[model samples]
Target: MSTAAKQKAKAAGIRLDDDSMDTPSEPLAPRTAPGQLIGLQGRVHSQQAEIEKLKRALEQRAPGKLPLEKLHEIPGRRRRLTSAEYAELKANLTAYPLAQPITVRERPDGEYDIVAGHNRAAVYRELGRTEIDGIVLDIDDSMVEYAAFFSNLLSPTLSDFEKFWGFKSLQESTGITKEELAKAAGISDSHVGRIMKFDLLPSESKDLLATCPERLGSNAAEQMAKAVAEGREDKVKAAIERLVSDNTFTQAQAVAATKADRAPRDRHEPMVIRRGARKVCQISARNGVVGVSFSGSAADEADQWAEKIRVFIEAELGKQ
Candidate 1:
């Protein structure tokens, strides 16, 4: 395997000597030859430190033209903008130019390597503006993944949908995997998995999240992904409405929604199901939708007991 692949293997715990790829035994990260990690680790750490220094400098550099000849396409990067979206952003760039300069590392040949802000760089290309603003650094393309992470955080990046796709793209472009980014973002592996697993989502649905990543999130988008995957467009819309109405449809909630059935009165009525003073289910409403959460063992038996109670109540009501 290549060096980058080896590094990713190490990060992902994919052992190189796995005699059986089909074996279910836990795998190990791919190994490098002896003494390789020492230098590789240091370079990675140093590259990170260098980017930290550039963070402050990045704020002060005014946007301008990038010398076209010196500019290079970002390695492992591509444009995710739709044609219409690209046009709109290009127009904005034409009017105001870049508010911030794209960060790059100097090439051995005296050119520059783009670190962050490919979208803006692409706009510069579209407008035919040469010699744009940049902060030349010393790191190589191997460590450019750091720039992508910081860019995601440093600015009003993608809409939730866009961020999801962008995050996936960055992962693919760079060798950084979802597991690594998820660890950085303080989410679970499954959480990251759900975020990137948007295969069946309609283009419209994907575009919605891409346009509004802030309103949606990794977890929230996952719910929509599941709903679409399950062919429950109507349920997806209702769940989103309920989610928004109750104001509890966070990204985590979105993921959870995809995994289970929803209640009917989670939003409008009191959702208390108790047996012998043990409260089994508790409902919290958001965005006009009610959410019912179960607790303790009573939750395990709630459905059966609820039916019994309903029958008893009907009998009592019939007597009245």
Candidate 2:
């Protein structure tokens, strides 16, 4: 294989070394019959042939312009941009030339599959453009999905919910564990765990997030997941719905809404009544009762003030 092919394969986590291409000499199972052994060998040979085909296709090629109609969208390969973001992209493309060419790979059917830049291509089409500058990668079909994933993963605007689904899709595609994914993605395992909390969300919440992924973040998702585990799924779902509908609602407030009981009221400081730096009394309210404690000379006159207060209340009641 060429050095370029080796590099691409390595980036996709595929080993293209001679050792990996060699067929197994020993039977996969000692109890396997001759026919089964032949079948296994045939499968290995087929895989080797496919790898060689991919390597040959990886020969250097310059980027060229391709028609927009020829570029096709592959499901699960591209992240959907929000409507506002799409409009901004369209406006930018209209005012300025494309800064970067999209990447695509040619198919046997004489069409191209988009490996990245789905939004740019879409914007160009919306602008009534006929062709777009594209670099055709000669990678295998299996590697196309991974290419698209990594491309979208690096986007700064990708939301936490979108990232969670991306990680999930990559995991299901590669069958790798969370730890392995963390290492591969160059992120902490704990971060991966936190992102995966989206999986614990109810179907209704997931549906809402699919529409507005930026509504909730990883931290809020973790809190909601804990609430779900504690049998508060309904509250969590309601909170997420409110969050989606109300743009002003924050992730922290959404998590708070999932609590079974209302948050405790803030404590109020006592109000001190003083006479020229002398503490006369302190008035405070706690648990629905008001208390007044007199100090110094005020203690002796407390009964007099109490009688005045009683008389004032009686006069006010008589007016009412």
Candidate 3:
């Protein structure tokens, strides 16, 4: 150890062995390169200043009022509040003014973007107020999805469709697949997949589910989506019509009934056409289309029998 270091250590109550240090060496002084020492001192001062700034920030109050005109709404993966929900919020706020501050981030355009408390800001606007209390945060643009999601997590009135759309928006905006988002959002992967299927549904079916989101749970929606995927377009539309017409049936029952009604019927043997001991032809009908096939011998006589076949069909229609 240098002589000055030894002295300093000794002054600081550090013990050293004198006999081991008996070898002659240049005396060690508390020497540091001038520039390096200045740099280190500057670093220490900078760190202490940062610590003080953090302490002051922690002690600061919530941000003051932000003008409604200067606030820009956040887009992507956020649920729109229902009219009833809006009314309820307005009523509550009317009874009692806002106690909690909303959250926002300053934009480069000199406007603030809302991070949370959309409904509150909306209510304030409805009340003819020009400004509302909020806190400014340093949220990254990439984190907006999670931030919007968690902000609405505690809401009790959000519908299944709304949540689905929110998750979908997150998936699209963040470039994450539904499976990855499912884990992050604390939803089942299968459920996420099912919700995403809503986008694939025909517009008519989508509107039905959107209008009555509470009626159709994820399972029923998935079932309907599966039916759509299987090319049961007419059946899905019919099912949606039935659901709209009859409010008595639950979504599950409606889905079940639709599935049962659309199930492929068992193949029935074609009706045999016989004249006495001779089998003439076979008749079959599927999806309202009728077909008649002639035996090898009768095939040559099909043209001759066409007039008779028309007459027979007319007779059958008359009977019906």
Query: Which candidate achieves the best TM-score against the true structure?
Result: 2
How accurate locally is residue 125 in candidate 1, as Cα lDDT from 0 to 100?
A: 75
Which of 2 and 3 is the better model by lDDT? 2
Worst lDDT 10-window in candidate 1: 10-19
Writing each residue's lDDT as its tens digit, candidate 1 over 127-194 gives 87766777665544444554555554455545444445545544543344566667555557786677
lDDT winner: 2
Q: What is the TM-score (0 to 1) of candidate 2?
A: 0.62
Query: In what order do the candidates fall by lDDT, top score first?
Result: 2, 3, 1
- Identify the runs in model 2 with alpha carbons over 4 angstroms from their true place: 1-63, 75-78, 96-100, 139-141, 188-190, 229-231, 259-294, 297-320
Candidate 1 whole-model C-alpha lDDT, 0 to 1: 0.58
Q: What is the full ranking by TM-score, best candidate first?
A: 2, 3, 1
Candidate 2: the clashing residue pairs are: none
lDDT (tens digit, per residue) of candidate 3 on 1-320? 43223222323341111123566894553366986566545644443343233324323646688999888776532345657777988898889867666667789998988877788887898899998888776644534444554455446666666567566554443345566667655668887787776666567666665555555566677788788777776777777767766778677776775563557775876799988888889898877777888887899998878878899989999998
Error of 3 at 7 (Å): 72
What lDDT does each candidate get?
A: 0.58, 0.75, 0.64
